[model samples]
Target: AQSVAQPEDQVNVAEGNPLTVKCTYSVSGNPYLFWYVQYPNRGLQFLLKYITGDNLIKGSYGFEAEFNKSQTSFHLKKPSALVSDSALYFCAVRDLTDKLIFGTGTRLQVFP
Candidate 1:
């Protein structure tokens, strides 16, 4: 079974500083990793994904992730943080059955 883990329960960053949400995945074959962000009382919003090709993939809201095969990790990153960016972030990977397996999720808090 494919699984994803978010080692951090929460990440704190000042508004205007860079922020990162860690994610590591375990899969049988080629990994299909994804990142999503959920605001308060909102559904998960698509952030980015790594299917193949480029190691670095950019997504909505100035977010990007690097696919590191050697490390088996795909960490989400943003150059600058914002108070509005405070939300719950999730890391996921596709299972052999083509279903998404998500991590426990990491809450991001950006302080001013």
Candidate 2:
């Protein structure tokens, strides 16, 4: 079965600094990876995705990810961090069944 792993349970960053949430995936074939962010009381919001395109893909709210097939990794990144960006970030991959297999979410705490 395909799976994703978010090694860090929590990530702390000061406001105005850059941030990154690590993600690694395992699948049988070409992987379709995605990044989502969840706010305090809101549903998961789409951030970005990597699906047979340029290695670097950008998405909503000043976010982006790099598709590194050789490393089997797709780490989320932002040029600068904001306190409002604090939320639970998830890394997922499309499985053979077309279902999203999500990793243990990483909580991003952006401090002021």
TM-score of each: 0.98, 0.97
lDDT of each: 0.95, 0.95
- List ranges where model 1 is wrong by over 4 Å: none
Per-model root-mean-square deviation over C-alphas: 0.6, 0.7
Q: For candidate 1, lDDT tens digit of each residue in 1-112?
A: 8999999999999999999899999999999999999999999998998999999999999999988999999999999999999999999998999889999999999999
lDDT of 2 by residue, 1-112 (tens): 8999999999999999999999999999899999999999899999999989799999999999988889989999999999999999999999999999999999999999
Task: Give the Å error, residue 105, model 2.
Answer: 0.2
Candidate 1, 59: how far from true, in Å? Answer: 0.4
Looking at model 1, which ten-residue stretch has the lowest summed lDDT? 92-101
